[model samples]
Target: MDDADRIQAASKFLLQSPPGEINDVLNDVRNIISDDDSLQAGVLPALREYNLAQFITADVPGHQHQSIVSDAARVPSGSSDEDDEQSQDRYWDPRSRTSFRFDHLTLETSDPEHVEPDSESEPFRVALENAALAYLASHYHDGVVSVFSTPGSASRFTIQIVANKYNPNNFWSGRWRSEYVVDTGAKQVTGRILLNVHYYEQGNVQLSSTHSLALALPPAIAPGGGAAAATKVLALVEAEEGRYQASLNDTYAEMGEKTFKGLRRALPMTRSKLDWDKVLGYKLGAELTNSKAGFSAA
Candidate 1:
């Protein structure tokens, strides 16, 4: 078929259909594209093109993570500018999406006999990290969580939960994080969890929402307490984490769905839908012809 016919056919196939009929339309489009070598070569790539980096640029809510350690010290260091660029490029690739953050979380305890106040020997950092991980894992089983240790003599660290979704017409990315700093002398832990969701789609649309909670809790274990005391603290932390997780999930779900509908509602309009293949084909052919004419004049 000629360029005009090709554009018309493609436009008809590309018309946005009702959500329930989307899968059937997609199968038909694929079959059509496969039958026409020119359509497969010229139009399929344009429809599939999505620049995730341009859309996933929003930072997580209420926090910025700056690590002093080099890539060699941290497993899969993603803090540097170069690393972020690489991640952005590979956002759609499944291999780059895997995370093993829970492996770094381990319970730490002080030597019961020599439990001196504010002693450097206590493993408060690891214990705190473990507590945060436990909370996240129970709630967001499919999420990718990462743990980062802060530099200097401060007894603190951060844990982040990252999740993303990519499809034919939608892109979504979210990050929720908590930073826990422990006081050995006081046997207390203080920090906050921040949750945010951001999504973008084909119609030049964007939506986002954020929620945060401040936390102050007893340490996972008392300085001099042995395994018995540690068990009690762990149970308490679990219950507390459950409460916070529920609150964050409820708020995020409500906001995310509201914005999701706001953008999708813009897609289909009017009483009758135009045949996108025909519409896009006419436009594409006209543009192509104009471009050739301009180039010849130049």
Candidate 2:
């Protein structure tokens, strides 16, 4: 097809395409018009459209879709045993692995019975939610946070951070969902953080932990004190959030370094490592030759 026709044809697919498939279309276009700078320029709009498509396809309503094409494209190559070992090691790195998320924050009253805050506390509750949203917007990078509160029940709120990835060909899968439920009364915030990590691939490992956290809110913000109150609330919650985020980050590192290792050994427990050359020579072992698990077999 001519350049205009090709660009037109490509835009149709690109606009409707999901995040995974966008790169495919772009690659095809580049291959077809490698030397044509002007043609590439014409295609920029379609590429921009792909950016918008991600936000449209995000799993959570308010979240921005994070494209994993670049990460997934980093498939390990070369036939050396050392390269294979290095690749395996890289797989366990938490950042590269497709896992874990800060799901949401559930709010509760300070009462012993753990009921929702009183409706009269609307001003304070809103102040809290606004502070949280601001904190998340600035601090969290991978996902977006949103607030969900019922009309009459102004005291109860569910502030959530949603992020997800879906690629059938990816080796790593599953989710580590973490949520915090805290009491909104008083500056000394106390709450429980719940974690549930369930991995579908790489030995189907699962890990979980629940713990309580407390932080003293920053000074200067008083309950129902309007804008000034909101600013102080932001700092207060930000401190608590920093702590909560630190806990989750530490847990992820532990999962990669210790928890996952204990569950699945990359190498057998023997003193000497198995000879990969011999194993790859066998028919079944031939499949291992392909860095990816199912790709070579298929």
Predicted model with the maximum TM-score: 2
lDDT of 1 by residue, 127-245 (tens): 54355456556766444443344444444434444434434345544544433444334555554454444444553333333444444445545534444443344455456557887
User: Which runs of model 1 end up more than 4 angstroms from their true locations?
Assistant: 1-122, 126-137, 143-169, 204-212, 223-241, 248-298
> What do the candidate models score in CA lDDT, each in turn?
0.41, 0.45
Model 1 TM-score, 2 decimals: 0.36
Which 10-residue window of candidate 2 scores lowest in summed lDDT? 102-111
Which candidate leads the pack in lDDT? 2
RMSD in order of candidates = 19.1, 20.6
What would the per-residue lDDT of candidate 2 be over residues 1-298, giving only the tens digit for each residue?
7878876776676665433445655666666565566655666555544442232211312223231211211223345674342232111111112221211111111111112334565566566556766666786554543333333443333333434344446533222222333234444544444443444455644445555666565554455565566566456555665676797799789978997788876777885678877774665656666546667567
Shift of residue 191 alpha carbon in model 2, Å: 2.2
- Count of backbone collisions within predicted model 2: 0
